[model samples]
Target: MTATTEINKIINEDNLVYKKTNLLLDNEMHYCPGCTHGVIHKVIAEVIDEMDIQNETIGVSPVGCSVLAYNYIDIDWQEAAHGRAPALATATSRLMPEKYVFTYQGDGDLASIGCAEIIHACNRGENIVVFFVNNAIYGMTGGQMAPTTLEGQVTATTPYGRNTALNGHTMKITEMIALLPGTRYVTRQSAETPAAVRKLKKAVRKAFENTTEKKGLSFIEIVGTCSSGWKLTPTQSNEWMKENMFPFYQLGTLKDE
Candidate 1:
């Protein structure tokens, strides 16, 4: 046998278990090391690839760390103002009812400035999926405290840690939206572990599937870590998230219908 034929035979003997999805660009992601955004992006891309919806999928990228998502996800994308992704998604989905539309947003944009837009979109049963990334701090705009910032959590705006007595309590936007009649699915997940990644992928796939089922709305809240913003290494940030963020936010489905 020829050397080239031998090499090709050996390569074919090994089964490939994993490969990067083409739905994501070859460009290096801009997310900080230990950040879950990269993982979340991979999961979303995997789902899009598996569902064969890349050509039919439209994503709304909101102002935040993920504002550059359009650069990474190789699909139709629309940029929205800080916290206005839902509004844009609503319009896009309405105009192209056959396309799968989703919004990718962070805590600052979704829970703080764009809270009203999301709330009303859910209440109105907009046929769209909302991917809410809750890292608790304003990652893109320095480590500022956000609406979902945990009480006693230190941030640039809250140097001494968040004080509920003065700042009010953390906003549970996912829970609030789940209670709306227009919502069809709502789940809180994380990507801190291998098991969590699998669950997150399933949740995302379900959310995407719901868009085609004529569901009013689907919301997936990913409780993620911001290593730089939180002043912790990637490893330490995951530990901090588990110990701090999980207690209040909790995991699992808040609603499903």
Candidate 2:
């Protein structure tokens, strides 16, 4: 089958079933078809399952598409107000030092509104892990431009291409977080393929380990596809991300020790 044909298959209703990993439960996913949120959820689930942290981990899910993440990951979960996942997570992590704590947030939720919280949390060397999903556009709220939306990328607010002169370039969270004295580990990965998904799961597990080991703040950014927001088929979105975005954002662990 051609690329478009494969993309159609990826978007077909039959393709949306939960992985045997069951990262996502019965709660309806608010994400669009071909959205990578499910894939990221799978990575979190697999890591939790692999590390046996389901009973000991608590996730602080923030507003945005990931607001429903707590419904998916079968662990002690808490919901934070918009852009406050890090603050809530910091409290939880400090209150229960023995428990693994992490926050899952989207580009808009993290880079745009939650920026100060995340930076301060990392600065204080908070013992928490952060899983940031950077898809450039706001998946919720109908594909609005997010803080990480690249220049020349169109969105609900930037239909004529994101004007770098006005909007600025995409925010580089991995780099930003790595600079914080509190952060001991940072990595950026993708989830477009099975191999990539496996790596992403490892990165998540590593983040959890940092908190569990009481090392310090750990940050992970998953460069994912917002198929519906980007106005492309799943396959095309994946390819576009690889060719156009990876060179700029790149992927790999930025800090670890």
Candidate 3:
């Protein structure tokens, strides 16, 4: 069979998108009020539902707010230790190559504790998908300093604002990962606006496509909001992320191979 024909055989309409089935349960998300985790979770669920991978995929939840995502995704999931989701995903994907394995991690998990894990995963070209959330601060632990936090930003730990001289500088994880040969796809997106969410869905689908092709790593960094951490209402938080962060972080596909 031709490569195109063979690939098409596995992805047909009768089994994709579960419009008839609501995979997510309606439990109250533990994320702080106005946090973007809920929107990101829903986006992932929608993609999973649309792709019809509900029964054939595995998800790894890392530390921070993403740990409880299994409750909402309605799929087989595993929780990785503190910041080991990438390592866990690598092992799982290597063992079950046909099963779509993904990791949902935060800035603290992906850019900090799991730094080596994710970088290795990308360098090794593991056929895994990573849903990275960069909300600037460490939201789950009452808003502390994070690797992605912008300069002059105030958090519980950075009471006087982040100082380049003292705290170093914020790291751009997505752009850094894009430089790795292991990554077949890399993109930066946000959930601040409906228009942005629509664009994010396309990136999410491409990440899964990379996996189906057994290409390499797929990394998508989402600029999310932390209302509780930022001391702003939900609406205000979203606006702030757009105004102050989006220009620096921007949003778009970095590469596709």
Candidate 4:
């Protein structure tokens, strides 16, 4: 056989172990190399595809590094104002109670300016999924100090390292949300390794399953990386995240009901 024929023969479904989900578009991603957004996006798409809910799913992505999420996911999407994705998602979920609705938000947008929006939405027990990607610092906005920035961590705004007295303690938003009565499922996950990615995928699938059952709000916090903002290579960023971020944010399910 010719080289092209041999390649095509090996690429058939019978031989293929894995492939990109159809729910994810073929467009080139714009996220910085090594950023966890792409991996998270893939996991979401895979869940939606596996559940065969692509047509019944809608995503809301607000201003942040994830603002362009709509460009990659094939499902219908709505762009919300900075920190307003939860509000928009709430409305969407209420208006179309049969459809699965979710919001993709970044730390700066969700933990900072969008704090009130998320709290109220969760407090009301809105039947929606909230994907909170917490990279600690503000990744899209010049690496500024964010609400979740680690104490004594350096950022553009905190060149001298974050001082507990001067900058307030790091916000553990996930834990705070877990305590709310409205949240039926709350978990913190990461996507750094093959095993970690599998866990993250399982968490997302569970969240979507909850949506199908009309359960209360499901919150998934992905403790992720921001290599560009952190000024480190992708490998180094992963190591740094496991060393620093995991100790504070931790991982695994915080609440399930």
Candidate 5:
């Protein structure tokens, strides 16, 4: 056998401890180094593979950093206008009740512009999952302040640090959504470490599984990092998120039924 063939044979004979999930495509991730979007994507892909629901899953992509999520995730996807992912997901779940439909949106898309659509969808108890990635800035369209921007946080719009008096309080959208009667499951997680990523994967799995039971809306808010937007290295961004974001967001299940 040729050298390459021999190497492949030997590797195949060895035990595989870990490997990328097939649900994630081979396309290079467009997220900046240290950004948590890649990790979240991997966690979701793994969940989909583990549940054996790849063939029955449909994802709604929002018009933010994850606008091209379809490129990286190997599954059927639909693109929604800015912040309207939950609305599209609502329709997708209603029209194809058998399929697992989820919306992947960033803070800019969800909390800022798509606020009304998301609230109404959850209030109506649409049987779908909504994955909200809160990085506190508009990552795709320049690092502008977002509705979830932490108090005292600095961004392109709030260059001198967020002044609550001027910019208003940081929105606790997850907490607000949990109060809706239509919401069946609501959780906040992060992807800063292995333990955190594992927890996030479990949360994603739970949200996906809830759809099968015809549970009302399931919302998962992932408090993530944006290295480029934060003007910090990936490592620093994670540290900063832990120090600043976690305290306000508070990771845990807000509600589950």
Candidate 6:
């Protein structure tokens, strides 16, 4: 066999232990190196591909770091106003009852300006999946303090570190969502390690399955890293998230009913 043919044979599907999901487009992702958005996106795409729901899924992404999520994920996408993804997703779910709908949002977009929208959508039992990526600080617009920013964490707006007395306590929105009666499932997860990535993939699959079952709402809070925003290397960002974000956010399911 020719050398190129031999190499191609070795790289064929039967020998391929892993490959990128087709649900993820070839578009180069805009996320910074070490950012967790790309990882989370991959997990979601894999879940949809595994479930064979690519054509039946619609994703909504609002303003924030994930505003361009549609560019990477190969699915029907809707762009909502900043902090309004949940609202748009609610409408989409209602309009297309048979299709799966999901919202990809960031801390600043979901926990800040769009807080009310999410709360109401969950309360109303929207029958959609919500992927809430929390890196604590505002990543896209510049490293600013976000609603989920941890106490004592420094940011562009909080160079002295977040002070509860002045800045207010960080919001544990996932816990709050779990308490809402309209929500059928809510969990906090991360993707800093291989095991963690597996767990995250499972969570993503469950959330999409919930939607398929006509469950009210599935909220997956992915406590992620913002290396550039944190002014840390990817390794440092993962370490810092483990030392800081995990303790406060705490992984595991908050509710599954």
Report, for every candidate in turn, its global Cα lDDT versus the true structure.
0.90, 0.83, 0.87, 0.91, 0.88, 0.89
Regions of candidate 6 where Cα sits further than 4 Å from its true position: 1-21
Better of 2 and 6 by TM-score: 6
Estimate, for each residue in 1-257, the C-alpha lDDT of model 1 and write its tens digit. 11111112223455734333477777877889998889999999899989988778889998889887887778888899888999999999889999999999999999999989999999999999999999999998899999999999999999998999999999998989989999999999999999999999999999988988998799999999999999999999999999998999999999999
lDDT of 3 by residue, 115-152 (tens): 99999899999999999999998888889999999999
Whole-structure CA lDDT of model 2: 0.83
* Residue pair clashes in candidate 5: none
For residue 215, give model 2's deviation from the true position in Å: 0.3
Model 4: worst 10 consecutive residues (lDDT sum): 1-10
lDDT by residue (1-257, candidate 2, tens digit) is 11111122234555653223343466777777778888888778888777766667788988888887876666778899999999999889878888888899999999989889999998999988888988888988899999888889989999899998888877787798888788899899998888988888888887887776789988889898888889999889989999988988998989997
Worst 10 residues of 2 by lDDT: 1-10
Cα displacement (angstroms), candidate 3, residue 55, comes to 0.6
lDDT of 4 by residue, 164-223 (tens): 998998999999999999999999999999999999999999999999999989999999
Error of 5 at 58 (Å): 0.5
Model 1, which residues run further than 4 Å from truth?
1-21
Clashing pairs in 6: none
Off by over 4 Å in 2: 1-24
The most accurate candidate by lDDT is: 4
lDDT of 5 by residue, 1-257 (tens): 11111122224565633333477677777789998888888899888888888778889998989887887777788999998888888888889999999999999999999999999999999999999999999998889999999888889999999999999999999999999999999999998888998899989998988999998789999999999999999889989999999888999999998
Off by over 4 Å in 5: 1-21
TM-score of each: 0.91, 0.88, 0.91, 0.91, 0.91, 0.91
